[model samples]
Every structure is written in C-alpha cells, then in structure tokens.
Target: MLKENLVNILRTLQRERVFLLGSFVTLLIILGGLGFSFTEASEGGSFLKRFGEGLWWAVVTVTTVGYGDVVPKTSEGRLVGVALMVGGLLSFSLVTATVASIFIERKFRRERGLETLKETHHILVLGWHHDGETLLDQLLRRLPHTARVVLINQLPPEKMEGIRAKYPGREPLFVWGDYSREEVLLRANVRQAYKAVILAGRNEGETAAEVDQRTLITTLTLKSLSPKIRILAELLRMENKPYLERAGADQVLIRGQYDSSIMAGALASPGLYKVVDALLNAEGFTVWAVDVPSEFQGSPVKTFSDYLKNQHQALLIAIFSEGRALSLEDLLGDEPSSIDEFIRSKFVETGMTHLFGRAKMKFQINPADHQVLGPHDKAVVIAAQPPNL
Candidate 1:
C-alpha cells in the first residue's frame, strides 16, 4: 500500500510539477517576507487583519493580477514585493503550460495504450462460445508456433482458462466489448491484422443472419480501415454464405444442413466414419514425392537399381519411361538375340532391351534401381517402406 501511494504521489507531482513548484515558491516568499517585515513595520493590529493582507498579497502576486490596494512601507517589504512580482509572472506562465502539457499527454497516452492492447497479426476471433474454443484449438494445434491470435469477447478471464490450458504456451490477447462497436475494432487493432474469424454464440436467440449482420458491420469497418486484412466469418445457415462472401469476406466457413447425408451413410455402413477418419488423419497409405536426380538421364531402368537398394533402402517398384522413345536400335542396344543360343554359347549375360513396351521391366533389381536416376517425364514409380503388418 505504501509503495502504491508513493507511486501515485510521484505521478501526481509530475503532472502538476510546474503548478506545484511555482505555488510553493510563491507562498514561501510571501509568507517569509510578510512575517519578518510586518513585525517591525506594521502598527499593532488584530492578527486577522495581518493574515488577510498576507493572503491577499500572495493570491494577487501569484496570479500576476497586482492591484495596488496595500503598498509595502518598509524598504525590506518593498524589496520582497518586487521579488514576488517577478516570481509571480514566471509561475503563472508555468501553471498554464503544465495544464496544457498534461491535457495533450493524456489524450496521446490513451490512444497509444489502446493500440498496444490490441496488437494482433494472424487472427481476430470475435466470440468465446464453445465453437470459438474449438476453432482456436484447431488453429493452435495446426500452427503451434503462431505468435498473435486475438480474441474479442466479453467473457471474464476465469472462463477463458480452458483456452489457456489447451494452447499451453499460446494465449490470445482478449478484449471485453460488444462486437458491434467500431471502437472494439480499433481496440483489436483490426486494421493491421492479417485475418479475422467471427463466431456467433450458441445461446443467442437471434437468427444467424441477425448475429452475422452485426459481425459484418465490424468486418466492413475493419476492411475499410485496413483493406488488406482478410476476413473469414462463420454463419449458422448455409443460405447466409453468399451474403457474407458478397460482404467482402475472403471465405465464410458456415454450418450446412448436409450433415444429414453423412449420418444416413454412417447408419448404413458402420465403418464409413473410420475410413473417413483414416484418410483425413493421414495415417495410412500416405503419398510422398521423391525428387529425381541429375545423374540418371538416359540411363536404362535395369541399370539404376542401386538407388532403391543402397540409397533409398526401400522396395524398388516398377520404373516408367519418360519422353518419346528415341531410335529403336538405341533403345534395344546390345541385348542377346535368343536366350537358348546365348546360353549354349556360354554367353548368358543379361542386357537391357529397348522395345516391347514404352518402359522396360526388371524383377527385384534393387541394387540397380537404387542408382541416382533422373525424373521421368511420362510416368513415376511408386515405392513405399511398408510398415510392419
């Protein structure tokens, strides 16, 4: 409490520094001179008369409104009055400047404080309902390191703990305000933000269109202020999607009545949801891209098995030919004419044949397939490291 009081006192003193300093100095000079000069010079009088005269002089001198009502008779009193008059002019000016500086500073500080509170870059989610939490959770999970996610909702801090816990290190800056207010947009720093996602509260009895209309006003205001910020809004009805898109939303993620179709399918086939989940989760039979190498240009499929065997360390699938086949003789090269004759002649060396189909076929030539091979222009080979099954 003492620390807080001291801080408050310091701030107050700073705000009124000029006025306080001038007022105090003016009082000290007036009182000091009055007491010393009046004691020797003034004729014996009531204490009240002396008190009133001293106060009158202090006020007039400090305000630079000197009216010659009472003149100092003693040389000492006159000297003090001359000093007070000079001091009074400087103090009056100081007081005026202090008041003006405090007023201007307060206005600018309030604006800057609001701006700092609303700094957001990635998203501005407008409601704190269950769906809002779910949406935030999904986004946070997908982009774990995202820095700025802003929430504009009136829910108190206690109710937002779930979001805090789920995100762990990522918590959005929250603002308490009505979504329809223009000031709320300014508070959220919507102008400099990247995108906005507005959600409707489930408890609100109003139609989705009605709720969306209020959100749309905020979106339009934000867009007008910052034309580059993309808006992604949510709607309860599918019919409202077009309206939201027309209202300048880059994308409107809306709830549709199409869930019934999925439910009907699920009821007919119990395993449908499982299959859908597998595909969506990327848990099975994933697709991967392997870059082609520069060394395998014009090399025969049977000549590059070392890639899959030694380098890739995976199964060698079939290789496909790329581009139109050049001269048949160049493709056929020097393959044995007949298997029986070549074997009889003790020449059973296997060689690549250029022709029967667009691409050549080889059986488990893993070592040759593993060689650095260029990408095919026509077809790609499918290789996979099968999980233990």
Candidate 2:
C-alpha cells in the first residue's frame, strides 16, 4: 500500500512538473558545493575549505540571499558562485509562472461552467423557465443556510452571476449544457444528489407538448442513472402527469393547477389571495411535512397535534401517508400464482418493471381527531421552521 501511494505521489508531481524542477535545482546545488570546496582547499584558515561551509555558501547563493559571511576567494570558486546565481533566477521565475498559470486556468474553467462539481447530497435543479427565479428564491428561503444547490441548464455566465447576486449568500452552482444529456448530468454529480427538480422549460416556438416531452425525457434519464434520487417534475399540461410518473418521478405537479382555484377564492372573498400567498412564500414560516416519530405509532391524531402545539409551537394541520402502506410479505404475496408470474415476466420484458409495485403518493389534508397514526404516517404542519421531530 505504501509503495502504491508513493508511486501515485510521484506521478502527480511529474504531471505538475515539480519533480523535474526540484531534481534540476538539487543537482546544481551539489555540484556548486563540491567545486567550491575543492578550489578553496589550498586557502588555509578559509571557511570555504571545509565541505560543510561550502554547502552553506551554495545554499545562500542559490537562494539569492547572499549572506556574505563566507566568501569564496579563489577564481574557480567565484565561477561556481556565478553559475549558481544564474540558475537560481531561471528556476524561481519558471516556478512562479507555472503556479500563476494553473490558478488562472482553473478560474477560467469555472466561469465557463466547464469545471466538474464534487458536492454530494446537494439539491439539483434542472432546466430554467420564466418562473425559475421565483422557484429558486423559494428554494433558497426554505433550505438551511449551509445547504448546497446545483443548477444544470444553458444559462450564460453573466445571467448566473445576476441570479447569484440576487440571493446574497446562497449561490447555486451552474453547469452550462443541455440538461438532457448524460455527460452534463454527470458533470453536475447528479448521482450523489439528494433531490432533483425538473422544470418545464420554454424554448423558441415550442408548444406545451414539446416542453412536456423534454421534461419526461429528463425524468427518465435521471431515474436510469440514479434510481434512488427523488424527483419533483413540472408539467405544462395536466394530461402529461402520468407520463412523468411512469418515468419514475416521485412527484408530478401541473403548472397553474391551483391558480384558477385561488383566483376564484379571491373573487369570492377579499384578501384571500394575500393570505394564501403569505403561507406559500413567507420567509418567517411555511408549511412542512415532517415524519412522525416512532413513539407516536398508535397514538391518536389529537394527541400528536397537542404535543406539537405545546412543545414545539407548531400547528399540526393534517396527517398523511406517502407511497403504499405495505409490508414485505404483502408486497411479495403469500405465493406467486402462475398468472402473477406470467404478468411479472411480461412487465420485465416490456421494460415496465417500474410499474409493478408503483403507488401514488397520497395525502390526507385533514383527518378526524380520533384517527390513529400509522407507522409510516407523516404530519403536515405550519411552523416557523421544520421541527426536529
């Protein structure tokens, strides 16, 4: 293991040209020291006559320090000193230029969005549209100050800078490219991401269906690369929701689905829209879905509600369950019949295995106080921030 590590280190130094420069400098120092000692050997009482003193003089001369404490009086010794001085100037200048060029190249790549990111567990946002700025603002507001976010799109560097300036401290990394491409996704380190949001982007002269098609393709690609990444996708048409769901999206939302209802409510009752907008976009507080603790498994909904209100100052608005509530035995039934086996085989052959155990995420907006909490239940609450529980 040690030998392998040493070889790796040597390879890196060679790639950086540090090894070559170091070897050259070492050779010059050794030759200069030996020559000085040999030439000054006849000068009795001269410090340079000693090999150790000669080495010290060589070090000082090569570094351009010129301490002048041990001077070489002989002609041959002075000639060695002149050679060391010229070599020192050339070597140090090359080293400085090499270091500066490396830094400049890295900066250039980053600005062009050509640098690959290595962040893990980061939020990935794919595609950009008219409402992208608003979406980014809400995400930044809800996320913790230390959380990382990466944006994959074809936005210009200047536009990215403008977006960063708007959000003061929370700057999302930008990777410029066609987001549907696998190479671009890999550059953003999508496999290690925690969650992804796919937006319905608007391209020049493209219809709603065309936009939805792009979203579907992106969802399919993301799931194929990282099956575990949770995806929330947007659709321009409500009819395209199923396509996104089958493409392995965890959540599918239609654009403007609630706008009509909110607008109607505003017409019926004044100031209704303001209240709803505040809840959705307010920085002080927002609605959050929190997992129910294990200790709350068979407790009544009213009890959990009271505990949140009293202990954490949070309001529990509803109790909901995500995905199918099924056990391992239930999922893989008592025994697969001949017909079941045949159907499973067909699904695998058709590349529709994703639909075998698929279940829609269900939410119960409000439940009776007597409702008992299930093991996989989650509490929908309104609080200043998500509760630790």
Best by TM-score: 2
Q: How far is candidate 1 from the true structure (C-alpha RMSD, Å)?
A: 21.8
> Ten residues in a row with the worst lDDT in model 1?
347-356
What is the Cα-based lDDT of residue 39 in candidate 1? 48
RMSD, every candidate, angstroms? 21.8, 5.6
Clashes of 2: 0
Q: Give candidate 2 misplaced runs (Cα > 4 Å).
A: 1-13, 43-49, 166-169, 324-359
Cα lDDT of model 1 by residue, 1-389, tens digit: 57865765468657678647765776765674465346435644666676567667656665667787755666776666777777776766667777677668754543233323535465777775666765776566444375678777776655654455566567766666775577877777777687777776654577766776766566556555565667767777776564454345665776645578667867888698666545334454322223344465556544444454455444444443345532234422164454223222221122222221222322222235334344552223333332111
Residue 132 lDDT (model 1): 70
Measured against the true structure, the TM-scores of the candidates, in listed sequence, are 0.45, 0.83
List model 2 lDDT by residue over 1-389, tens digit each: 57865775566557889768878888888887888878888766555447778888888999899999988999988998999999988987776676677668767877677877777889999999888998998888778888888888888888887887777677888888998998999999898897899988888999999999889778767866776688889999998785566556778889999999999988988587777877888657679888899988899999898899998889988777767522222333356665345434543554544532345456677778898999989999998878887
- Candidate 2 lDDT at 389 equals 79
- Candidate lDDT scores, in order, read 0.56, 0.79
Best by the lDDT measure: 2
